[model samples]
Target: MIALCTPSVWAQIKNSEHPITGYAPVNGLKMYYEIHGAGKPLILLHGSHATAATTFGGILPELKKHYKVIAVEMQGHGHTADINRPISCSAMAEDVSAFIKFLKLEKVDILGYSMGSGVALNLAVRHPDQVGKMVLLSPVYKATGIQPAYWPMLPQITPEVFKGSPVKLAYDSVAPNPKNWPVLVDKLKTLYSQNFDWDQKKIGAIKSPVMVIVGDADMVKPEHAVELFRLFGGGQFGDLQGLPNSELAVLPSTGHVGLLFRTDWLLAMIQPFLNKQTN
Candidate 1:
């Protein structure tokens, strides 16, 4: 079961005391983003139904100390407000790309969790030039990448299921039109239920270095994560050829929602990878 981290809880624990928050008009939607710290850019994408604060609140202080963290709220999620378009990963990626252009940032690192991981993947694939390095946490590269049991549960995630839940509460608290709760839920259901997968060849063609992080008990299967790692030139015998540009980490005793909350563990893995010089 995914643990809910409400905004109220985040405010208390978030390390970064303050952030420069704003909305960027991109792809017909006012995409909300928060900038923290200074230095190299690091774009953060939150999972489905999660706000930026809820996803990365715990790690903001540490992350910001090393890079300029840009946390974005995708369409229909968090402060971005719902839009008329479909909530597919590709569409969200395009919005992120536009947001990057709007900010005039050249080559930035990106880290995404769950649904956001898919968006980060699409962004790196479609606009390779903009992405420097990537960190995908519990990403779903293909429909089958998700565990079999999770597939059946997707259709059952209707608007009614979210009533009184943290996700709904979070949405109601910040959404411009709180009454449009049903609309956002229904759109997310559509996004979750859709059968979508990126082409493996195209994914393999991506040049930017990547780090694939997954929890042992995550919704995404471990073997599938390994497959994704291999597609990016990882999983080879490192002792013989030296480590590949890509890397993978399967955190023990962790689940999807718990993955982001493990800030120290994530930073330990992520910082080293990001600090490495890219050839």
Candidate 2:
């Protein structure tokens, strides 16, 4: 189930025709963003070392039909250049908060993949009023949520490791400084090295309803996803107590990157969940 994804397996942002594209000055960084469609705002956050277009391009068309999709490329990723500050979810979350304010948006729905999940979670916990709903795909609440086997590979990751890979190609295609791939990798390495554990109280205290999705064969432990669901008032006998505001999904036979390919399965769950009323 652990296999490398080819370039064809993922969609590129440049291939899609988006109506709005610009760079926003937020938190001392120029963040690249694209806005498509109309109606309620939906923010899309990509995984580590990924661009929003590469991460969500496959589903962007469908997402835009129903939402005012705002896909952003965070610092050191995509068209955004690297700054002297280190990369961390908390800091990125702050950048996003500033972005929302910059856009003059009141509340928006956020869908975050992999590393973006951490940023989404941080935003929900830190600025609950600004987030209406959240979708956390392949989330990690603590360092240990990552499988033990994958831990050994983190310290060894290099820009060269992604050579000739879709990840690298996507980065090379649109990054402001394509040669700075190594710099992005190094910053991400520092982010991964830092000890991170969101307090259980913070997870449980998040008021915004969330949808947690993961692949059964994901690098993140399935048990860890379950634990997060429990914190969201899940793991209950719904037949007796009614459904919780939050939701959980485990796509069968899916790997981490493979989870993005399951677009049909994702929309099937996401559309109804997002449309459902919280009140």
Top lDDT prediction, candidate number = 2
RMSD values for the candidates in order, in angstroms, are 1.9, 2.4
Clashes (backbone N, CA, C under 3 Å), per candidate, total 0, 0
Model 1, residue 5: what's the lDDT?
67
The count of backbone overlaps in candidate 1 is: 0
**Candidate 2: Cα lDDT at 23:** 91
lDDT of each: 0.84, 0.86
Q: Which pairs of residues clash in candidate 2, taking residues 3 or more apart in a chain or in different chains? A: none
Residue 129 of model 2 has an lDDT of 90
Off by over 4 Å in 2: 1-17
Model 2, residue 204: displacement in angstroms?
1.0
List runs of model 1 lying over 4 Å from the truth: 1-5, 12-17, 192-194
Per-model TM-score on C-alpha atoms:
0.93, 0.94
lDDT of 1 at 199: 83
